[model samples]
Every structure is written in structure tokens, then in C-alpha cells.
Target: MVLYLQYNRGMTPTEAGQIMMLQAVMMTICAPIAGRLSDLWGSRVLATVGCLIIATGLGILVQVNDRMPLVVIAGSMMAIGLGHGLFSTPNNSTAIGTVAAAKLGIATATLNLARQCGQLLGTAVLSLLIAIFFDGRSITPQGYKDFQSVAVWALSISLAFSLMAAWFSSRKG
Candidate 1:
């Protein structure tokens, strides 16, 4: 989104950064509330709902083009942030809760490992998609279409994965 704001919309970096801050702000505001809710209600439902919301945000992103409104982008970013805020602490709590007291350290390590692996995998996938389209070039005005195509393709794949996570989250042991 910052890239789109800068290259496609001709905005300055500061403006792009400011707009993207909405996502972080939303996440910061949501995490504690979600943690409290998870403690009271259980993580399962909140986690599932969070993944669904992330998928919805990605669904909106899949339709993005150069001409799309910044408001739409901001909203999508906020949805994603809100989703992560709702999902992360609960998921961590649930995972950590499953381990014995003596194994808490191992559980935390394993959780961090899983998160690192997921991040690496997601980055690699997005890089591959960008490479296929951008071919090591910068985003020229003419190449925004290619960038948009890659973004749509990648976000669609992400949306699918989020939906799958929701399904898995909703399941019982």
C-alpha cells in the first residue's frame, strides 16, 4: 500500500507512511480488547472471526487498481490490522495454554518458530509473485498494471489461506 501510494498515486513518503499508520493504530487499539475477550470467551471463536476479517480485507485488496480510492485502501489495511490484533494474542494464549507448566519455554520457542516460518514462507511467495511480473524492474507508471496484477494475485492467495485458517481455527480437537 505504501508502494501504491508512492508510485501509483504520486504521494510523498510521509503521506504514505501516515496513511499506513492507520493499520498499526487499529492493531494497537484492538489487541488488548481481544486478549480480554479471549480470556473470558475462549480463543476459538475470536480467532476464527479474526481470520475471516483478514480474508475480507484481502478480498477487498484483490480488487485494487491504480484508480481505487485511498479510503478503500485504508479500510482494507484497518481490517487486516484489526484481524491480526484479534487473532495473535488469543492464538498465542491458546497454544501456550496447551503445554505443561514445565514446558512453557519450549512452547514459547515453538510458537515463535512457527511464526518465523510463516513469515518467511509468506515473504518468499510474495517475492516470487513480484519477480514473475516485475522482473527486477521498478514500478514505472506503465508497470503499475503489472504491480497491481501481482498484488491481486498474491492477496488472493493470502485470502484463501486466511479462509483455511478460519476453518482450522473453528475445528475441535
Candidate 2:
């Protein structure tokens, strides 16, 4: 959406590129810190907090509009990057650490496979939602609005799931 809007406004790709770069930089900076923190604090707390942060970013993203500022978009991206950085390492460590040494390879493979499958499924679902919202219309302002509505709905659902994950993570084991 940002790319589309930026293109329409005759802005160069530099702005979009910068936003992406910012996200990458944030992830790079936060990942190791989060990993260390997770080691100190435990995976449950870090992962739950990460999920909540991601949910917050997505919730903010639902409000994206043509009138929205670039700073807001960049900030949202940074939040998402930070959240993922904080979530992934600890979650993986927790999963792998919980299993027996003999099952380590299997556990690692299963974790990676699940991650890929989730990504694929999420992409497909979001794509379907976008198509449904488009309703075969060209990309107009109204179409963009419709897409935004679908995005909001999708993000809201994701947020609910994230909250659920957080809750589950918080439970006594």
C-alpha cells in the first residue's frame, strides 16, 4: 500500500526503500539484544511481549490511509521488525531446548517446516482476502479503501491470535 501510494504521488522509490532499510536495521539491532534478554528472562515473557508488540504494530497499520504520514508507516514497520526479532530466537530456543537430545534434529526440522507452512498459508489467505475486496475492480481510491478494510479485518484477527498465543505462553507449564 505504501509503495502504491508513493508511486501514485510521483515519489521515487527511495522513500519506500528507506522504510524497508529502517525495518532491517531495527531487526538487526534488536535480534541479538532480544536473544540475550530471552536467555536472562525466559522465552515465555519475551515471546509474549513480542507478540503483543507485533499486534500493536498491526493494529496501527490498520489505520493506514493516503493522508497518513511516512513516519507512522516507518514506525510501524520498525515495531514489527523488533517484535519478530524478539520472538523468533527465543521461541526456537525454547522449542529445541524442551525436547530430548535424541530428537533434536527432528525438532529443529519440524520447527522450520512449521514456520514455512505458516508463512505460505498466511500469504495465501491474505491474498485471497485482497482479491475478495478488489472484486475484480481496478486499483482506484475506492479499491484501496476496500483493500484497507480487508487489511484491517485481517490484522485484527491476527492480533486476536497473537493475544491468544501470549495468553497460552503465560500459562503455568
lDDT string for model 1 (9-47, tens) is: 788999999888988988899999999999999999999
List, residue by residue over 96-138, the lDDT tens digit for candidate 2: 9999999999999999999999888777878788778786777
TM-scores, one per candidate: 0.92, 0.84
Model 2 spans > 4 angstroms off: 1-14, 140-142
Q: Give the Cα lDDT of each candidate.
A: 0.88, 0.76
In model 1, what lDDT does residue 76 have? Answer: 94
Q: Name the 10 consecutive residues with the lowest summed lDDT in model 1.
A: 1-10
Cα deviation of 125, candidate 1, in Å? 1.3
lDDT of 1: 0.88
Report the C-alpha displacement of residue 60, candidate 1, in angstroms: 0.9
